[model samples]
Target: MPSFTLPRAFRAARITRTHKISAAVVASASCAATLALTAAPGNAETTAAQAPAGVKPVSANGLPLTAKDRADDGAKDRQVASSLTAGLKVTAVAKQGHTAKQAADRSADRKIIAAPKAAPNAAPKRYANNLDGWIRQSLAIMKSKGIPGSYQGLHRNIIRESGGNPNAVNNWDINAINGIPSKGLLQVIQPTFNQYRVAGTANKLTDPIANITAAANYAANRYGSIDNVNSAY
Candidate 1:
């Protein structure tokens, strides 16, 4: 019988080599698995990067959809945007129409309430600024205030003092020398005019009615009546 046996050193060396080879193979396989795991995320990122322009990527939690679903979603978005734009346009048009109608209504109301034109040959509503008008106005005021005077007396004084000129001013008289010139239709001085000034008459002595009223009042106070005065009164 023949017995076959290796040397102890050679056998130990062979066993050690086998163990190292096995360890190397296992380490290589584990490294390959790690590389595959790392490359999987990179491949997924590359796919995402290479996707079509303007196309929305699927969300992480969203379900996958076909091309028809994507097309329908895009159509719905466009339809909604178009509907909103149309609604805004219609609202603006309606607002403009309402504003125009309001303006038209206001114009029509103004026209409806417009004043009528004057008649062709109607008499004037105001009194003319003349001697007769002044006397009449003053007489009306005198009657209301219980002042005693007549149109004849006022006319007589106006003619005697300044010849019915309501704008008369006695600048060369003794009263003028005193720096208080007699003014207006009756040529009354400012002091006398102010002293005997009547209510409801113009404050200015140059005013025809004011002068007449004041002169009448002065005459009534001093001489008891303007009818008695005939000269330089």
Candidate 2:
């Protein structure tokens, strides 16, 4: 066999590099083509491209499409027409609605619990030191998770119940029947205590955040508001 020379070695190396670069380029082009094919039809627009005139279901690559992608193209015309008719600003419109809701929520919050106060001499409450912080956190949870009507009502009702005392309870049988741990701001009963399964466990009632959330969920579902419990008990 003839021995290979340096020039031949150099030629081989160049060829190998060229092959590698060619393979990479081909792979990249293939990927791009596949993505493009998976994208909207010829007339369709890419998601990165300008959004259409109205709310439109889009392919992965961002083109006007039907919700069910694999369906017949015939349905595409009518469905897309409906989508446009309903207002083509789907992404923008939905996002705008959410933004507006968040803005409104913030506006309402400013008016609601402007300066939540914690009595200096009183027992533990949600805002042991930072009343405003606690109120803000609670309000955020309410806005995001949709606080129940009862829980919402309880915001004012709680001023009368525990006066924001997370660890409040009746010294006498003023709140409950058995004198078991009617814990949290809601004065959650023993059965509810067992139901939520938070009795005397770790955090206990002093956990203002957990206590408030649990109490709010309970009040919202059970009595439709904390005021009902306040009236009954």
Candidate 3:
């Protein structure tokens, strides 16, 4: 039997076929890897777009906000708060001013209402009980009341009865024995004095003008006026 030996051309052709199969396998693996890599980018884009509703998109910084965007939002919020605070302060100041004005107005009204009024006029008063003053006062009253008498007639009877003593009292006389003393400047008893006392004259017995006027009135009714009386009746 002769030994069989492969020819050089045949061996070369088989090695070439093996190399081509290996290259084809390497090209197929590379193409599959390229397709996977290209699809990965599309999937990532799709996933980002399909995020949950109402969720904020991520910024370049990976957090919810970038540095410049966060600073601008913070500044705007601060400005809004400052404006509100200033407006409130202005409103409070205006309210306080109005309250103070009202208080001042009330105070002014009270002062006006509490002011004092002017006093009324008054008549003149008497100073003493002198004879001239008493006579003048009695004459004035007599004139107002329509009583008739004169200064001379009054003086004449006052001198004759008790010597012008306003307090004269005759306790030892006959009138005294009957429990009725002659009293005053005219020395007239209580019954006669009280009965004859003029309306405008003093009511007291010791009054000078009262005694003289009462005695004069009594003499006028009984003896036809004091001007005709010369002695003790």
Cα RMSD (angstroms) for every candidate in the order listed: 16.0, 34.6, 19.5
Per-candidate total of colliding backbone pairs:
0, 8, 1
**Candidate 2: misplaced stretches above 4 Å?**
1-132, 149-152, 174-177, 194-203, 225-233
Local accuracy of candidate 1 as per-residue lDDT tens digits, 1-233? 99999999999999999999999976675565445545556443343455444232443454444576667767877899999999999999999999999999998888556788889899944656888898988888788887898889888888988899988888787888989888888778888998999986779888888888898888888888787788777
User: How accurate locally is residue 34 in candidate 2, as Cα lDDT from 0 to 100?
Assistant: 55
Weakest 10 consecutive residues, lDDT, candidate 2? 47-56
Give the distance in Å from residue 116's predicted Cα in candidate 2 to where it truly belongs.
Answer: 34
Off by over 4 Å in 1: 1-126
Better of 2 and 3 by TM-score: 3
Task: Arrange candidates by TM-score, descending.
Answer: 1, 3, 2
Q: Once superposed on the true structure, which residue ranges of model 3 sit more than 4 Å away at CA? A: 1-128
Q: List the residue pairs that clash in candidate 2.
A: 47-62, 54-88, 54-89, 55-88, 55-89, 55-90, 150-224, 150-225
For candidate 2, write residues 90-156 as lDDT tens digits: 8788999999999999988886556877768896435334434554555556556765543346566
Instruction: Give me candidate 2's TM-score against the actual structure.
Output: 0.34
Tens digits of lDDT, candidate 3, 20-71: 9999976675565445545555433343345433333345564554567657
Best by TM-score: 1
Which residue pairs clash in candidate 1? none
